[model samples]
Target chain A: MTSFNAALVRADTPQLTRVINGYPITYLDSGATSLPPRAVIEAMSRHYELHHANVHRSVFQTASEATEAYEGARLAIAKFINAPGGAEEIVFTKNCTESFNLLARSWGRVNLKQGDVVLLSEMEHHANIVPWFQLRDMLGFEVRFIPVTDDFRLDLSNIDELMKGVKLLSVTGMSNVLGTINPIKELSAIAHKHGALIAVDAAQSVAHSVTDVKDLDVDFMCFSAHKMLGPTGIGIFWTRKEILRDMPPFLGGGGMIADVSVDGYTPANGPTRFEAGTPPIAEAAGLGAAVTYLTGLGMANIAQHEHDLTGDALTRLELEFSGRIRVIGPRDMTNRGGVISIDVDGVHPHDVAQMLDQFGVCVRPGHHCAKPLMKRFGLNATARISYGPYSLVRDTDMLLEALHSAIGMFG
Target chain B: MAGLEDLYKEIIMDHYRSPRNRGELPTPPAVCTEGFNPLCGDQITVYIDVTDGVLKDIKITGQGCSISQSSSSLMSAAVKGKSLEQVQETIGTFKQLMTGHETALEDGGEPEKVDIRALGELAALQGVVKFPVRIKCAVLAWNTLSQALSELPS
Candidate 1:
């Protein structure tokens, strides 16, 4: 507990010191986008200041340095997730959304055809659902969902029937709205038993836990850098090198083509086949720095600190608010991450969020881009308070204080 | 408490807790349209029975924050007994207050304050205009009303 110093992490983040609404900034919206640490900021800035050039094709010195930095980031990310294929398997895209698009447009479009089923959990983010549906629209494949239980956990009772004819089992590792962490290895095992390739939407889980792709035995994994204390405009898509090598290129452009002629063009091999244009070089540097920063703090510590905080907050909120506000996510800390979604009786999420904002406690209020899950819960929206590695118990105290004020004002 | 009171004026809360004119009007002849804010999932359905050029009856129903629900309640109260033209005028004044315009002015130029007195308790929502985020909440019902009126037999 002493080793997990949120104060030190807070010090590394420059945004934590600022004042908002005459109150110290209590950021509880990390589920949307995490605040950047000085390490990430400086790495990106340093890249622009010193090493700035196009990647892959450049032969010059700065170009080679940039290429190395970019490749080094791939290595770092691959290692971070403990990917078996290492750097060769990691493909950088615009964000997690683009990564899913690549998987659906390239792999799903090529491998899946009519009657092929794609199994998705009901609680998946739109990033995991929409791309497959977009492909399903044209391909005529059946998209089935594993319904969520009333207690906010995935229902697997009918999973065997649901996985029939399923070509791909694409699901979120952790729900962005519910914070329920799915058992990835077990799900992968089930998907494999059903002869379906599994893809993990690691957008929420990758930042919160130890993500070992090899251990989980997942075929494909995608996550956004911004959610993991890195820069935006960069995301990671990981798969085994052999599978990625054979898949047709998603976007055909300069960097993605090995040979181009007036009559025809040949797409490059490996992950580069997917990366279309000049990659996010500076962002790669920021991601690399973020990797180093997280590595230094140790992901296990970050996970533990946030878990304790979440357990504490849930206890306090339930005890204090009691009948006023009900938690939408798992009440137990086990199998759940740091996301806390709550429904205030007789109050809208927008009102709750606005009242919280008056006290400089930022929390996201909406469907959280999971409309199906919202409809599943019969909820329009819920006020979500998410924690980052830098978040502390004090943030939770301020959130509760704001909650009391908001409830009192309405009463 | 100080900051919150400005936003959730007592009158606003009263109207929110018990919104007036909330329900589906009988059947046809009464035009109804729904306004939805996709960002926060706030939705409002405005139902109006316009006989000839006058609003014989109007109802505002939806689910959302206090500002939107209360604004809908007050809006239904204000426009229920007014002619079509008068309802349009009230809509313009509410929009001006929310967007900070000159619908408050009488004839000559006075202060830039909103015409809260004319709008009645509806003017209590003027505090929302300061919060750029909540501006849409205050005007969602009014927008739905306009949409509903647009479809009214002309």
Candidate 2:
């Protein structure tokens, strides 16, 4: 197995070399979107330079090459998640948000009905929650939330009770705001026990953990490529082959059909039915290279590295800013990733983030698109500092330094 | 390019630390309007007591960044006892201040001609124009106050 070295990873990422203000950039916002390495960028550039053509529509050499690259990306992503049905299960969308929308509009329209319950969690990002809510508005389904405990974990104490009428249990694999890595396997078991199919929003967890959809026993998984060291404009929604076959098309136009007539159109077989019009060919190439790069470095090693960084940073943040800064997420390293949300006393997150910016530390400040979770915690916003595979201890050190400066300025 | 000091002036921080006229002023007697910046979750509520075509009393309430809260506080102090026409002028000036002269001209107004001295301490928030995103935070209070004024029973 190749050893995971953050310095080597940083060297490969062109963004890491950037300087902000007068200081070297300390990027700790990877939970929002990860920095792509040179390999991913070069792969995309190469595709655009050489083989820029629409896939599946043309028989030309360049078009075929583009199709091969695009299909190869789907296979790589399928393998990355250990999808049981492989490439046939992977459907590319605009982003993770679109993936959830596709799942809700297509699968939900078919299966869910009036009085059917769709269970979600309070800590879920808006992408996972809003689509279901929108669909519920139309289909007249009841949407219930799994409460978050005071300790920043999903309150599974009443999971069995919550899953009663829950035809579908959709939750985040890891919270974007809380950095709480949820027990997907355990939840999947409970969901099945309650006769509910489970879908996971793996936008945060997939990059920081080794995702095996088979092992997790989840029926559906949605994640964005941008958050997982890939490019934007491409995301994956993976499900079992039987489920994909049964689910209807989400966006209906071009490329997604076998035959189109004046009367009606028959949807294409497999994942292509969901992918309408020209796909993100260059982005698919970038995602393919990202998959290769992550695989080469080893996901296990990256996970461990991020775990150590998170644990250390959490501990240091607690010790140093004991009364000043309160961590909004789980303090324990167990079942957590590198996303750290902190609320500084007597300081708004926007002000704190602005202060940190002066020190060249990039942190995200806001509700993190988790309004329900923010309300649950009675917090408008928190300044979140997240880590990536390329992050190092120095990044945390920079964050701490910036935090001290911010507090000093705001205090 | 502007530094932190430019955004968080001493007067602005003072207003944020000790916000003036902060509390509810009874909705029946005072019209309360809430302004929200969905981008950052910064919110401000403005309560205006209009007495015979004059804004007699104004109170600011809500939670937000320093710029927002301070802008609300400064705005409350500025327009507390002003005539309706004067309050309208203040709102227009503050909005122009946040958006800058380019937008003012784009809206078919005069050039960059907002009198800085007329804004008084509100001019402290002028630096917000440098950081485009925070302009919303600075103007949220003004927008809410404008709403409150419009809602005043004529």
Candidate 2 per-residue lDDT over residues A264-340, each given as its tens digit: 99999999999998899999999999999999888899999999999999899989999888999988888998899
Best by DockQ: 2
Clashing pairs in 2: none
DockQ, per model, reads 0.56, 0.82
Please give, for residues B42-79, the per-residue lDDT of candidate 1 as tens digits.
88888889887899998777788888889899899999
Per-model TM-score, in order, reads: 0.95, 0.98
Using lDDT as the measure, which candidate wins? 2
B36: Cα error in model 1, Å:
1.3
Off by over 4 Å in 2: B102-113
lDDT of 2 by residue, B7-117 (tens): 989999999999999998998898889889998998788888888988899888799999999999999999988999999999988887777565664566544645779
Q: State the TM-score for model 1.
A: 0.95
Per-residue error for A333 in candidate 2, Å, reads: 1.0
